[model samples]
Target chain A: MKQLVRVALLDSDSDVRFGRKMIISSNPKFEIVFESDGLSEDLVAVADGLIDVLVINQRLASGAGVSFYQSLRSLVGIKQATACVLTSAFDQPTLLLAALEEGVSQVVSLEQGPEALMNAIAAAKTGDQALSLGELYSLVLAETPSRELNQDLLRLVGDLPQKLESNLRRLQSVWKKGDAAELENFELKSLTGLVDKLPVKTASELVIRLQRSGLLDGE
Target chain B: MIRWIQRKNWIPEILLATFVFVVFGALDFATQGLLALLCSLVMSASLLFIRRFSFLTSALVLIFSTMQVSFSLLPVFALIGLLLVAFATGSFSQKPWREVNYVASVFGGLAFAADLAFNPTLDLAIFGGTIELTEAGRALTFVIFGLLAISMITLMWIFGQLLISRLLTVGSDIDRLAYEKQQLALSIQLAEQSKRFEIAGEINESVVQRISSVITNAEGGLYAAKASPEAAVRALEKTLSSAKYAHADLRRLFDMINLGEMVSSAPPSLEDLDSLTIAMRETGLDVSVSYFGARFALDQSAELAIYRIIFEALLNAKRHNPKGTKATIEISWLENGFQVLVKDNGVEVERKSALGANGMPLPYDVEDDIDSLLEKVTGPGITAMRERAESFGGSLEVQRAVGVGFTVSATFPVEAIRAAQDTSA
Candidate 1:
């Protein structure tokens, strides 16, 4: 017997939910653990153990998918999930950039067939980020750094910008060399052992810059 | 149109001119003969032009009045006519006119005092009595009368200026308040328009997603055709089902956007209720309106919402039945709220047969029962009507029975109905 991947679905429309369920359940290697059109606050209580993958729609009747996922990740025991796939009907650039900053695993268009979605879920279960070629190009083809990135950088370093200028030059070299993933996986724990460094919001920005420079789309 | 209103801004000058003719002209004509009457007439004429060309009026009045005093052309009682123009110069004329009136009044007072000291008969005409005077007494009398004339002229000018300024302050305050009210209303309209565009965006997203679902299932079936025949057949079956469902959803959204004949930007009021019922009756649905308690007021938006709910209910009745559908609209004005109930007998026969064909529906009070969900019927019209009611802090309730037909009721509180009246007050 194959080891079945546990999957759950979140979508408001009943017909969309039914169609997606029919396709996903036909695969023998994936198990349908939980299903709901909505899970207000009772999802934590109902889904006790943990789900391997959570496939959520972007434009839910509840709210935006990224904020919803952030709230869910803060719940006890649910934060340890291996993959979170955001399904969208359209490609919103701001949403893509936010997903990258928020550590979302992948964003797949709702127009994609079962094979593409199943592959995404299968790869995400093995602790890897996934992206389409189109999404990869949108992130890597940066004419200049986004306006939000510049504001975030200015906020990180206070006034007296001369020192900030030098620090940014060294930082750009590190990002271009693409050694951020190695630092997190370093044998001696070079940076994780260092105490009390950057604020949480700035740390999220650094992760986005690293992923953008490294071209870490996995696909 | 705006120019017409601006041209009428000199209404106070016309009124002041009328007062001068009535009081000064009539009194001088009755007491001091034609000469005094002519002098008062010229003073009134100058007052009429004070609002438009005030400096010129002042100059003309001074030059004319100085000639009369120098030539000794009239009686002593008419000499006080310069006071009227002094007040006018201060009230309506430019700054230069006011200075001319001040200097001219002082010189006129000195000349009049000299006349009164030398001419005893003229002094008696003005003061109602005269006194015998020596050489020293003549100087003292001239000094006293000059001071009295100056003080009386100054007081009249100051009074005119103070009264006119107070009137202007009140007028400007009212104008400012009216402008502010118009600005606030415009902003509210802009906010409502943006909300409509947002809804349009959501509708586009929803419609496209529904259509794409059918395509996704069919394409998946095409890829499956090379594998198992059974899997391919099942996928095609799902594809057909999704296509029909998507078509139904699209129709529902279409109905949601176009609720009724309310495409016009002007919102409908309860006054339009009579015409709505007349139109519904013309369509063959037996409709009637009945009211309870005295009719009261409601804000424009709330009235429009009620109008739409009634219109949708009547439409729903006609759509469900073939002909002769009896519907009643009961409007009740309560102490703290308003209520509307629409009851119909359209599907009474079909409902009883439905009980035998599909089994008995659960009672209306068992709201959470699963059987209620299966038997209840609601279309896009009903949902749209409910949303309209809820947006204004009101509510809608629906009921259905096996032997009876459909009923929908909506209620709005007094707070929403009285919002406009309260804000204006």
Candidate 2:
């Protein structure tokens, strides 16, 4: 018999938990061994042991969902776990981009219905990632050429700034030079200012840049 | 435009002349010359006097100057009349811009009409010192003046329409900014709550989890048959103490977060006043409260503003009185609106220069803060509170009391509250 897919569900809503559990039970291949309204218990347990997939809600207490993924990735042996964040409100582009940056397997909306969610979970089990149409549009638009935009245009469009842009560039330069002190200082102020103004994807681009340069040690 | 004139800029006068030229370019040469002379003279004279730079005077001066050619003696006579009107308009002028615009419109209208009526027809004929126009010429002159009058009327209409549209745009922009401000405040509230949630999560994991685990272990030990009675009792006591400490910490943490949250959230009311009074009592201040108003829902911002004004009043009392035994807080919702009075009988504090969190004295006096972090955390307390009251078309005031303490009060226009409630519903 094929190994049953182990799933962990994290949400603040009781109804979502019941619905998710019922939907998971209907499928023969997936089994949700852990479900929790609070991320601390179920997420820490999953990080400490074997868990094939993790599902989350958009409106976690704070950086609850993203922080869980960070801790899970840092776990000694469970580095390759697939992750999913299920959200009710799909308006927040920032949360979706954050899930992606944390190496989430997929982000599905709770409003997308049981079939679509089940399909996403099934895909994650096979190492496939899928984003909704809106998420796809946000991601595509996220790649817009920053150089083509001036300050006024940036304010009208993404509101991502150039100094923050240049700080990001300087961050890249410092990381390439292996100046950790300079990179840390420059990144702290620039990233804080930039993160507030820029879309999460653009901000994450810098994170990926730092990781590639070995300044940031994360998978 | 008058403010621009008051600044003594030449660009507007040149523009005004250009406008006149454009409007009356087709009039007979002599008539145009006379009108120009009158316009230039009156503009120069008004620029010298007329109390301040006024669009009304500029237009009036232009009119009177144009009238100089038609009612040569009457033009001088009209000056006194024009001056009287100007003085009357000036008296009504609490809003200078509006008054100036009014003055300008009147003057411009008079100039336009006079230029239309007395347009000189030089080619007709001269009788002694007076020039006579032929019947056709005289009729033609009136026709020309009629056309000019029609043109001037159209010009004034266009000017008025443009002015209204610009004013509307400005008004709309201000409304947009106010809405944006409210949205930004909401976003800040959400973000602050999100941060608190994260902090609470950490505390839950660290303190709550640890205590729960100890209690669970103690229970297991207590139930175990092999364990001695004394050992079990000690374990139970330790668990109980730890649980109590955890509970206290949780309560304190909630209080801190609640205080921060309440700064944004509207206070319950003067009726539920005891919660605030109780909270302040814990902070070591004896608070006395009073109120009198038929309960009605106020604008959320207005209520929050009044709450903050009171909160700040209490803080000021505490800051000034580190040794004071008690303080009095009095609040009343009156027909005029809400009022807050806080007083403490304590040692008079020698006012120190406002220092930031770092203990560095601010370089200059600021009603708010020089430190961005401190400003971000606490500075908005007073300003946002004031803005909140003002947002509901209300006024807020703060002042040092006669004997002791600081008094803060806010008054809302009776109509503003009603209007907001009606629109929101």
Candidate 3:
């Protein structure tokens, strides 16, 4: 009989909270102690620091949940609890990075299914960031404004174009390796997440053509 | 690109200055000594930098004219350059020199009169012929020519002043037209962008969120299916319901685009607040709107959005409270941004609650405490209002206190509203 991870979840949407609770409660290794639709005095009133994991949606009622968490640090409890943020959108890297920098344990995207969130929570308790910090960095780099990205690259590495080419070549080689066990790799899954987001007409046309040619399928 | 800033293109003035020195200066050299030609050369050269250094040029014009008057060698080139300098001073000179230019030109005119009166050889051929005169005749000549010279100099300077202002007015009109064109373009762009943002927000908050919820419910069902098939079926049924909502919302967005329903008439804005208050008052909610800072026109979409947000708050106040509920809506356009604060004496919930925990029409036939009263007001309406505010990079905060009542505060930064629009207020 392994010890179950006690979880307290807070999300602004009641439906989302119900869904998340159902998912967490189904897992025998994780037990939901408390849940709320949003941050409130009721949180401290009910389940103060007694839970193993505290999962908060990044966007709370007032503002960023990270700020709320920062304020919560002063409540003279919760020294044993770990916080994991469920980000709705990964477009803003500054906020994501801020969450990571503010000692948030994990940044799980809503796009990933319940499995990823469960893994993030389980990993948080074990003191592991196996969710791939490299993937996070790559996403951050991909989303950074071009001007600032160039300046940052200049500070760290020398030539921007050369570095970009090298990175592409390296990624190509990595894809060519095609190791069977690497199917679960985070990098491959997160490949060109931004490219998927960008609404380029040419790409859409190619995708349509491929689907018509039976080389692709509609999602 | 204002003409005043590019005053360095003094080619025409320089050409005229050189022409004056070459032709009239030759006459001065031929008539008076080398010193007279040199004096004429110096005055003509002042035109080179008149547009650039107005004060210096005007000063030089006055000094040399006085010297020529004292020397009794009123050169031909000096008089020609004086007219140009007077015009330049009126147009280009700033502050004290602009004022000093009038006195300088007058003095130059007096100098000319004196030169014509005392030195008969330098009388301007344009005005009259040189006449042999006694001491009394010279006195009479000075007074007669004084008026003509004074009027001529003053008129030239005044004409310069008028010409510049006329050019400026034309320039300003052109600038205004260009600005209006840009504003129209920007308004269209922002309207389109705002539509896109709203769509994104809609998809993000509702569709994507619902799909994510469905995924969670389905995953939860898969895990729960191992033990209890009936409960798993119920959880999986929720997935279908959630997916249907996501699909419907997504279709609604696509229909908005496909049906060309994106373009519509301008919505009601801040200007319609009076009518809004009237409408509210008619509904038995006394809503008073007070503007704190100097008010200016906001973007059509932003204005509409803000008006909608404020209206929602007032509506909340009305819906929550009894008839004749007094609500004060304060609009402040501060240096930071636009802020809307609406405070109302909400429903007196010291008595029994209107609705139950599930918001059904069933409630305990008992008195409610302050905490339960506060909890009862947390409705989906406020959440929707918050979503609307957040769509525009704004925030809405609701404060509920026992005696203090309910306050809904929303803020929109100028950057978010204006998109770099300038404001005098």
TM-score leader: 1
- Candidate 2: residue B394 lDDT (0-100): 78
DockQ of 2: 0.03
Could you tell me the TM-score of chain B in model 2? 0.33
Measured against the native two-chain assembly using Cα atoms, what DockQ does each of the candidate structures obtain, in the order listed?
Answer: 0.15, 0.03, 0.29
What is the full ranking by lDDT, best candidate first?
Answer: 3, 1, 2
User: How many residue pairs clash in each candidate at the backbone level?
Assistant: 0, 7, 0
Q: Please, what are the lDDT tens digits per residue for candidate 1 over residues A1-219? A: 778988887776655655566666667777767776655563573245567777777756667777667666566332343357777776666676676555467667765566777786786577444543233334544523343334443354434256434444444444444454533332211222110132222222344553444322211
- Which run of 10 residues does model 3 chain B get worst, by summed lDDT? B258-267
Worst 10 residues of 2 chain B by lDDT: B72-81
Q: Candidate 2: which stretches are off by over 4 Å?
A: A41-43, A62-64, A74-82, A85-97, A131-138, A142-219, B1-302, B305-425
What lDDT does each candidate get?
A: 0.62, 0.51, 0.64
TM-score between model 3 and native:
0.38
* Interface RMSD measured for model 3: 1.9
DockQ of 3: 0.29
Model 1 global lDDT (CA atoms, 0 to 1): 0.62
- List the candidates ranked by TM-score, beginning with the highest: 1, 3, 2
Off by over 4 Å in 3: A45-47, A77-80, A83-95, A130-219, B1-203, B255-425
